[model samples]
Target chain A: MFKNFFPNKILSLSNNLLNSLLVYLILVMFLGLIYSLYISPPDYIQGDSVRIMYVHVPSSFISLACFGIIGIASILNLVFKIKFIPLMSKSLAPVGCTFTLISIVTGSLWGKPTWGTWWAWDARLTSMVILLLFYFGYIFVWKFVSSFNKANKISSIIAIIGLLNLPVIKYSVDWWNTLHQPSSITLTSAPTIHYSMLIPLIIMLAGMIIYLLIIFLMKYKTETIKFKMNKIKNKK
Target chain B: MLGKNAKKRAILLTLLLLLSAVTIFLIFKSLEENIVYFFTPSEIYNKQNISFNKTIRVGGLVKENSISKEQNSVKFIITDFKNEIIVSYSGLIPNLFSEGKGVIAEGELKDKKYFIAEKILAKHDENYMPPEVTKALEKSNK
Candidate 1:
């Protein structure tokens, strides 16, 4: 049933989805900001600084999520010889890198007011730093290697290799004793967060994901078009 | 019986996989010791021949009314239900540091009973005080 899913139909669907998603994203982001800035109660201990969680948490989540998509695309490329997967993975690196950077910066801003330091060599923070380096190394391979096949082969390897770090990053808090607290939200149980705080957090998470989707789709479309144009030019 | 190009690709893929496997193995092997950043009070208490003045971390909730301010330092007790350790620190505590809150103190163990903290880390939840801390404090009170 899924065999006839052609590229043209998928592209058009993505376009329509992208338009609505953008509008929805903007509206949701606005509402989320309102709740984060005004509605949520100040933390009993950390006070207003806890509001930084709205940005810091979502950015870090999206950063890891971007790498996850890249890893999946790399796996498909490696196993199934999918032509566009490498480019899609390439498109995601910058988005992942940018969000990783945001996560670190916002985390530092949050840390200063709460942890009394801008940076710590704690496990979570260090693992995130390593993730950022992996993103950079992946992007570096794509840019420095001019041959398409060469870039694809090496970049995919980097993406696949980086997969080992994801589990480490996710489990770092539980497996290690670091300044970073263990995650309160778990898959098997109810979250420890209050509904008032969780609502805005969920909204912001949705907004960030939609934003990532918009950027990733745009990058994918551009790369696909560029490949098609080059092919046509080469034929002439 | 593979084509020449397929043979090369397979070799390259295998090499990459092997390289990544070795890299990950080395990283985790080297990091094994540093992985566990802090120990609970119970974990510390159960250890034998523990040297004093060597730095370590013990994590638990700050026992209520255990904090006493002195001219140069502040002292408090951290407990993990079955065990407790006193921590002394001269520096300013983080904003999140409070009685009945989860904390991890890093410093030399003067003994199992006292921790001269070089640093004190008080953990806070996304919304409020973390639940495990409340549970620990309650358990100790009982």
Candidate 2:
């Protein structure tokens, strides 16, 4: 069943695709770094410290998106009993965890210059910490649970429960009087940020997303190889 | 096999429903208790029984021309545009702290009208623009 889902041809194609993506990722990252660090204008209030937003915003966004992917994949695995979906979630968990950590760290750095404190127990910050814990819990289940079937079910349920925190994290600023400012760019309204800063931010976001794709593809490939090896051992 | 699948689905659905229900109840309860990160000046005014000893944060805009620097302490009026509270702080303020900018002062309320801030934090809005653009906007507003 796993072999059917990830055939040799598909694996080879993914290898080629990963090579092309790597090239693109390098080029985009170079441009993104240049634009965010030098080309972007300093904020009227924050000056150079505002550059941290280029990294902080993208990491936060990617962390949230990765969890969303994990949650949906877990639900599908549970409902349809898709044998390969667990592999995808397993590959994604670490990437999400790393990005969540990056977001928290960069946010703290940014907070010091702007909010005048290294950390605050504001709703947005606290909820993000909760999200990080959820990611840890999800990864922990997969690591400690030795049985494959039990690990899959337990991790999926953990991912699903973590999904509940996403909305809370997104809405925490608006719902509560957090030190973190409300989102400038919302789906419902025009962005309040100026074009000069917005361009670099978008570029950085694109670069980080490409980086995430690269990492995820590499991890998925490794997991697939491991899965095949396990199956062969079972047959032996 | 179909019965087993149905049973699994039912269990998963019940779990999701129960989890969400509990989450909603907790959120509502927290809201009722008002777990606010910071209270606005207007909110402080609206509170029925105000505490004096407890350290709380009051966030608002620094009223233009309301800043008065003394030898050791700086005094400013924080206004939510509805009500205002006088704040005096001796500590070093954040770089972004200025007239007409948002700020949050953490300290005990001496009274309904006065706040003695132990720490002062600058609160910037979400708007990010170049210095020139800000200057132009400020100029145009005047």
Candidate 3:
């Protein structure tokens, strides 16, 4: 565990690139949190309960984004046969799963008061739950399959098929008039939220994003080391 | 080399997760100020230092014939089989909130046993009557 911190690339990350990434993350988190928490106005109806949207909405965005990345990585692994691509996708499963869980938990928590129930099998919630299940199945497939080559082949197909759930999750609210709230941050609808709530939400989202990036890179670095160790052991 | 990399990952993960958790928790603290909690009638009695200044949820059944109102302020009784709670709600309640049904009141506990409820949650099983109420009623009858 101690060895994971000093990965070759991380240690060798040039001063410029390292500083730039740090700066980029800092700025992104700051602006995003501020925009989401402070800049947006509260809904005309829910008053303050509308505040949950800033955090819930962004986390849900990130969750979908992570799944999208997994899909791309899966494709790259299948077509180009890139070893690292599959690893990248594999590393993302848990992060995506965590975000999905948070989104569901917070969404349910918010729903109990607003929608009058802790959970409803609404379209948006149902689709996300399906996506989450796909994540678990896709991840376990790789973990249980020792042969990386075989796992990669299978996961690529699974990810591509699972991509279907993403569109379903995204549009479930848009297409269906479900009890789950329609998105506030869409291109057309002016965010019906206030700045006081938006600012903190954006800040937290940025913080979460930075947190995810740091973990992803760190996990990737760890996997690289394990790969090297396995190669060395096979040679011995 | 492995040891060093492993150590770095550990530190990095710890720092990142810590920062994330703290930031989110801080935001959560502020967010909760605008939210309410649900508790049963017995819970309201059990909790020490109950204050009436804010909002929370008191979960229980509406005592029969206990609901009364004086213009804006409506008073009701919530029971959890173990104990009964007196609630003074100052707002509109959900359609399902009625006497002899399970409801979770959201408001503040005022004056020890009294709760100034602001929102009422009518717990439903499939269509109505949450199973907790059914079970509690059976127990009382037995």
Q: Using lDDT, give the best candidate's number.
A: 2
lDDT of 1 by residue, B25-137 (tens): 68877886577667888888888877686777788889999999999899999998899998899987887888888887889998788889988777665345334455676
List the candidate 2 regions with Cα displacement exceeding 4 Å. A1-10, B1-11, B21-25, B31-34
To one decimal, what is the Cα RMSD in angstroms of model 3 from the true structure?
Answer: 17.8
lDDT value for model 1: 0.81
Better structure of 1 and 3 per DockQ: 1
lDDT of each: 0.81, 0.88, 0.67
CAPRI quality band, candidate 3: incorrect
- Pairs that collide in candidate 2 are none
lDDT of 3 at B60: 67
* TM-score for each model: 0.84, 0.93, 0.55
A104-203 in candidate 1: lDDT tens per residue?
Answer: 9999998887877788777899999999999999999988997888889788878878887898899888777677877767898888776777887889
Tens digits of per-residue lDDT, candidate 2, A154-197, equal 99988888887898889888887878899999999989899998
| Candidate 1 DockQ vs. native | 0.35
Candidate 3, residue A196: Cα displacement in angstroms equals: 4.5
Q: How many backbone clashes can be found in candidate 2?
A: 0
lDDT of 1 at A65: 88
lDDT of 2 at A86: 91
Second chain alone, TM-score for each candidate: 0.66, 0.83, 0.57
Could you give candidate 2's per-residue lDDT for residues B1-142 as a string of tens digits? 4468857885876688577869776875678335568898888899998889999999989999999999999999999999999999998989999999989999999998999999998888999999999899989999
